[model samples]
Structure formats: C-alpha cells, structure tokens
Target: MIDVKQPPYSAVGDGVTDDTQAIQNAINAAQAGEVIMLSSGKYLCGPLVGRSDRPLLLTGTVGAQIIAKPNTRTLLTIRCSASNVFQLEFVGAALTSVQPFLASSCIRVNDGLSGVVIQECKVSQFSGAAIIANASISLRVMNCDMSTGQLCVQAARARNIVLERNTFHDLGQSGFALHGDGIIIRDNVCYRAGPVGGFGAVQAGSKNILITGNHSTDGGGGFELQNENALSATEPSGSSCVVAGNSFTRTFAAGIDLFRSGVVLTGNVFNDCNFAAGLPTAFTVQPGIVPDLAGPGSGYQAGDILTLGGGVFTRPARFVLNAPSPNGGLCDPARPATNGNTYVIDMGDYSVFPTNPANVTGGHGTGGKVIYTNANIKARGSGYKSGDVLRGSTGTSRFPVLVRVNIIDANGAVLEAEILFGGYYTGTLPTEMAFAAYDTVSSGSGFTLLPCFGNRYAMQYSKPSMASGGSILGIGNRNVIVSGNSIVNHSPSHDCGILFVNFLNAPVSRWAITGNVFGTFSKGAIKRYNFGTLSYDTAWGAG
Candidate 1:
C-alpha cells in the first residue's frame, strides 16, 4: 500500500491544484494487488484509467474529494479484473469543473471484467449515468448515494450483479435499469426517479431478475418487467422475474406495471396511482396485442366484432386493448374460424348481461352465436362467476350459455355474459332474425337507472351504466393474477385504480390471488375482463 502524499510523487490535494499526473504516477508504479490512497482535500483531475492484471484498489480518506473534469465517457474507467473503489465523493468538474464533458458517469465498468465492488461512494451533477456496467459480471454496487444523473445505474448484458442499499434521488431516468441476466436490485430507495412519462423507477427487461424490498415515492412508477417485441427485431424478453416486498407511493400512474408474463409479484404495497385514462390497476396483468392495420384492409373500430361465420357485428363497447404485443408474445387468432360456417361473436361487459335478449338481428341456424340485446343482461344483473352458465329468456334465443364474472369496477357495474360458453362467444343455430332489437336499441340500455329525482350527483351518475353498457367491457384473455397490493387513487381527479382488458377473444387459466386491498379511486378501483379465476384473498374497496 502506497500513499500518494508520501511517495516520491508527493501529490498535493489543495482543492485547487491539478493533481492528475501525480495520481496517474502512483497508479503506474503500483504492482498487482496494490493500494493507492488519496488523503483529505480535493484532487482536481481528468479521466483516471485502471489497470488489468494488477487489480488495483483505490481508497480515500473521510473528506477526500475527487473533482472529475468532463470527458466524452466516464470519469473513472475500470477495464480491469477485481478492481475496487470506495469512500470517494465524486463531484463533476462542472459542479465544483477543474475539467469539461461533465456529461458522462463517475465510473464505467466496461465489458469482459469480473469481480468489481464499489461501495460508500457519493456522486452528483453528471449528465449521464452515475455508474454503468456493460458486459461485466459479479459487479456489486452497495451503499452508494447517486443523484442528478441521467440514470443512477445502467447495467446491460451483465450477469450476477447486486445493487443494495443505494439511495437514488431526483434522477433524470430510472434508479436502476438492467437489460441482462441474474440482476437483483434490493433494499434501495428511489424518489422521483423519472420526473415525467410512465417509466418505472426500476425497470428490468432480462431473465431471473429479483427486485425486492425497495421503497419508491413520487416516481414514474415502480418495477416494470417488460418483454418488448418490436415489429422489426426482438429485444430481450423478461421471464421468471420476481417482485416482492416493495412499497410505492404517489406514482403518476401505476405502481408496478407488468408487460411480460410468468412473474410472481407478492407482498407489495401501492397507493395513489391515477391509472392511465381508462385502464386501471397499480399492478396490471395486461398482455400485449397488435393489429395488422395496414395495406389493403382497414382495421376494426371499437365495437366491430368479426366472427368466423362470415359475419361482422358492431355493438359499441368501451374496449381498448392498450398493450402492444412483444416480438413473440402473441397466439394465433380465434382458430377454426373457417369460411362458410356462420358465426356471431359477442363482445360485451364481463359480468352484467344486456337489458334485452330479443334484439339479436340476423340469425342463421347452421352458423354461430346469436347476438343478444340489452334485455339479456337486464335479467342477469345479479352477477356471474367465471364458468357459470346463463340461459336466455323464453322470448329470445332460449340458449344455455356459460360465463364468468371477471371484473367489477368501483361504480358497481357488472359484465353481461351467457352461462354456457364460459364467458366466451357462443354459436346458436339460425332461428329468428331479430334485426329490430340489434339495430334499434337505445344507448346506455345496460345501466340500471337510479331514480334520483332531485339529482344531487352528476347527471351521468344518476343513470349508472351496467351489464352490457359503454362503461363496462372485456377483452378475451384467459389466465391472469393481480394480487396482494393496495391499488388506490388519492388524486382529486377520480381516476381508476386497476384496468385490465383483452381484445383478442381468447381463453386463459391458472390464476393466483391473495391478500389485497383497494380504495379512494376517482372512478373505480378495479375494471377488468372476465377471463380467469376471480378470487379475492382479502377484502377490497374503500375502507
């Protein structure tokens, strides 16, 4: 161990003098497994590069300061094996610049390095990331205070990296973002990670990542695990990730926004997420969907239901499948939709049925489902669980259909369903053409009108839409689980808390839910489609 102040180099840390060459000389003379120490006072310098074979260890006294000048890339570059940097307070040269490019990070562990440990370091006023690990392994960054950078830590294509007990405040981007494998961001605190947009405070797009025991406040949102399947190429699809024991408060939108599948999000807390416009839930289990809306054929509008039996029905519903499919996250459309076989598909609310069943227009016997009217939902407004069967009244298509009650928003609106098809589109033989009911029904027919003659609330609320109405909807998704969190809205705007819908008429299963609470939403707490097992582990709704 050689001290820079004691060597023949005799470096000065007067907080003003240029100490760049003095420190570089010590690093050059030191042998493998050597230590270079910087005593109290600021050493103003440019980039300090580390060695490969020597495995250098750089330490500073309690008040030692490294005021780094600006460079195109990082101020401290470590392209070596087993390099450790600790106890150094790095302030950008621009902040306090003996040097210019204050645009990069304090330290950058480059590719092909292993076993790097950086602890107890404080960095401020850099334009880019505080610490970045690219193609490095076993990189442990603990007990660091990083602020005012593009990103606190950006780790890409790395393995076995652990970031613990770090405080990232007011960062321009995410606190910790990873695009690699085996990364764990635990026991960290982030405040206002992304001041704008719906980005996550801790965003991951890799495999085997665990984000546990972290606390976030007033950020873009919390942990978002995504599998981005773009049109041209596919990025790394996150799989087998776990987010547990995390707490989030006052996020702009969601607390934990999930865009991938096969994740276990357990024992987390969330509050005040003004869920994006119509979609709800601080934690959403929404699968991505895409429309081939180009070239010769135009895309379908909101209520255009195309059935396999060469028929198209449009019964407008507030249906929006907001998640765009990842590169490989789509299954083939409703199969066996062969030509010449007539079919009628129903895209209605998940729980409440329509008010009239006799409204189905064109009924051909050898074909598919018969579109029911608001009358059908009016009769079954009590509620329907997933897989429960429902029968139309004698006046209408007296078919037995199965259904499931998937979603119930805060407004007490239920989805309309037939019992036999298990909440799916059913086909009945062509019998009667009830075109008048399908084409001439009045708007908001699904809502059960409240006879509030005085009209204390808004006119919209007096007539609450329910069953097969505009306010309630479902997109055909099968298996999903949104459990164990308090998804609420404290904002004065009355936004929804959780909104999960499916556009593709599909079936899913294997759901797990438990220990959850919800309340204080502007509109409603939960808005979902009747797709999977709707089980409640704990009591929810405004407590």
Candidate 2:
C-alpha cells in the first residue's frame, strides 16, 4: 500500500491546500493491484485520470474526502479495467444553480472499461450526476449514499452494470438514469428524489433489465420505463425487461409509468401514489408524442393529404389542407394567413405529425383540388374489428373511400373510424352497408408491435381525494396477464381499479384478467376504452 501522505510525493491532507499533483503522482507510480490509501483528511484536488493498463485500488479512511476545485467538470475519470474505489467522499461546490455544474460529475468511467467497482462512497451537493458510466461493461456500484444532486447515477450505452444497496435522497432530478442493456438495479432506497416532469427515481430504457426490491417514498414517481427513441422505429428501444417486487409510496405521479414495450411487471406494490391529482394512475402505460411546435410545412392547395414522418411510435395522421388566403385580404387581422403558412383544416384522429418540412409540398395555391371529407359511421356495424378497412362503393378505382376502423365494442360493433384515403367521389358517399374490407393499412411506424405485460400487481390507497384516474391504467398494451392481483380501498372518487385505453386507433387486445380481488371503487373494477378481445371471469363495471 502506498500512502499519499507519507511518500516522496507528499499530499497535504489539509482542506485548503491543493494535493492534486501529489496524489496523481502516487497513482501514476503505483503498480497494478497496488493500493493507494488516503488518511482521514480533506484533499482538495482537480481532475484525476487513471490509466487503463495499471489498474489500482483507491481507498480512504473515515472522514477522508476529495473536494473538487471550482469549475471542475469532472473530479475523477477512470479508464482502467478492474479498478476499485471505496469509502471516499466526493464533495463539490454545492452550487444551488445548475448552470455551472450541468456537465460536471464526481466520477466518470470511460467507455469500454470493465470490472470497475465503486463501493461505500458518499457523494453530495453536486449539480450533475454523481457517477456516470458510458458504455462501460460489468460495472458495479454498491452500498453508496448519494444526495443533493441533479442525479445520482447515469449509465448510458453500457452493459451488465449492477447498482445494489444504494441510498439516494434529495436529488434535484432522478436518482438513476439507466439506458443500456443487461442492467440490474436491486435493493435501492430513494427518498424525495426526482423533480416534477422528470423521469422518476429510476428511469430505465434498457433491454434485458431487472429492477427489483427497490423502495421509494415521496419521490416524483417510483420508476419510469420510457424508450422515447423507439417511437416510429422498426425496433423497440427497450425490451425484455422485468420490474418486480418493488414498493412505492406517496409519489407525485404514477408509481410506475411504462412507455416502452416487452416489459413484464409483477409483484409490485403501490400505496397512496399519484398524489398529483391530475396525473396518471399508480401504474400507467401512456405513450406520448412530441410534435414539432412549428406550424405544418408550407405549400400545397386545398385538400392535399400528407403523411408526416419522424418520432418514435409516431401515429399516422392525415393533414387535410385548407384554402390559404393572402395575408392582407379577406382574413381577420389577428389570424392572418401569412406567406408559406399552410393551414391544416383537419387532423383526423391523431395527435402528432412529422416535423420534416421536406415532406410538405411548397408554394401555396397550386390549385390542387380538395376532396378530403369526413366519413362518419352512419350505423354501428357489427362483427368488425379495430383496424379493419372499409371502402365506399361510390368511389372510383383510383379514389376509394378508404377508412380505418378505430374502436369496437365488446359486442363487435364498430364505434369509431378514421379516414385513411378519402377518395374523390362525385356522387354521395355510401353508408356502412356499402362499405367492405378492401385492404389493411401497413401497421408501420406508429404502431407498437411489441406490447407491455402486467401480472399479479397489488395497488391500493391511490389518489385518495382525486375525482379522476384509476388505480392501474394502461394504454396500447397487449396480451396482458392481470391475474392473482389484489386491488382494494381506493378513493370513492377514483374512477376504477384497472383501466385500459387505446392510442391513435391502435387496439388494446388479448388481455386475460382473472382471479383478481377488487374492493370499493367509485366507477368499477375494470374499465376499457377501445379495447379488443379481453377475457375476464367477472363483468367489468361502469366507467
């Protein structure tokens, strides 16, 4: 063992002196597998970089701290495989403002390093993440205490990382942001972590992940699994993850929010979660879309149907163009139709459109005819499934009245429909009787081919005073197994114990809900909106 205070290169342990060069010399001279020890005193240091070949162990006695100098981006950077750091406290400027430390961190492990271990360390008052591992494999962080930071740990593009037995509290943002594959997070405790609109205590967007046996209290939310990149992509951003045996209490938002696919949730417990009245339920699967705030692209005449692109799980929305008026003439002053501003007359049954301006036709008043018209379900047709295509008989071969089915009731009656290609027809449009299946639209881009599954979850005492929302809510999930679960004692104003909703005409189907215990909810035990092919033992109550 090489002691930093007792060597040829002596490091001052006093809190005021800079011991950066001394400690760095010791680290550089130390051989592989040797120990570099620091005795209980404050060592003010700048950034320290470790070698990849000479793997060393850095440990400290009680009350030993490494204080970062002002304006330090990262205090320690490790690129060595099998390096271990233990029992050292990392202290930062504790700046209240996040601007100075947005890119700063206490410790960072570079990419492609493996077998790095950080244990029994305490990190506090950093404006950014305490520990960041980028593409590092087999990294382990255990028994650490982290508090008062933007985030505790961020492992991105990494693999086989294990975070166990850690304690996080009072974070400005989330405790952990894990975006990788083969991650394991177990037995962690978080309190008062995650800010509003942030991804809860733990935000996981990884495949083959296991988040089990964690406890969270009074956080923004317990956990969130969102693969925002998966939207409009051919492959899911996250898949084959399991979140089980976790407990969450008094969360501001949902206890668990799933916006990814192929996740299996089981044996999770939620209590008094979703305290924010207008938020989602204890468990939710609400997929959201981020639209380009800028107005739809320029050019095009009245009645042009355009398909948008970009974004994950992007819904297919048909933007029907409206006649554009000149800026100064025949238009209200407040809402003038300026040059290059194309007005969308209708956004049919979808929320997000593409942001790429090149997809739009330019130069207004091309004199393209407007043939877009609303196709209503004049009569509720039976024996039709959601996503079924219907064609109008009055339409010519080129212009077929193509409508996509949106929602269907339990009795197989079509409840809603969206126009896919509203063909031009001179005669009156045909009714439901004249409609028949022509061809199904390609389930691409906006559809989630893989769905989330939930089984044996326990939810109770969620949103005690809230007049809306359910105990467990899901959207666009498929083949769910909600069996052997117990839901009880929800607020009287609560909507239901379990609720499932569809998104943008995508069907929620193949749910097997059996052997679940439900008690006193205001609306019912289970409710569904645009659901399909559900198998339940008991009748679902009113919503």
Q: In each prediction, how many residue pairs overlap at the backbone (N, C-alpha, C within less than 3 A)?
A: 57, 6
Candidate 2 wrong stretches, greater than 4 Å: 96-101, 197-205, 227-239, 278-467, 470-473, 483-493, 514-519, 529-543
lDDT of each: 0.49, 0.57
What's the residue-level lDDT of 342 in candidate 2?
A: 26
In Å, residue 101's CA in model 2 sits off its true spot by 4.9
Q: Model 2, range 1-543, lDDT digits (tens) per residue?
A: 999998697999897999999999998889877999999999999998887677868999999999988778799999788999999999875332111223458999888889999999999756568998888899999999996435688888888989999998756556787777787889999876643322342333567778889988766567766543322111244356677787777655556654444556677666665544443322211111111212323344455455433323223423444443333111112221111122232223322222322133223423222111122234565777765766654322223434445566786565554433323222222322256666654321111111111100111112222224444555555645555455554445445666655533444566666666666665676766442333221344542
lDDT of 1 at 225: 55
lDDT, candidate 2, at 11: 93
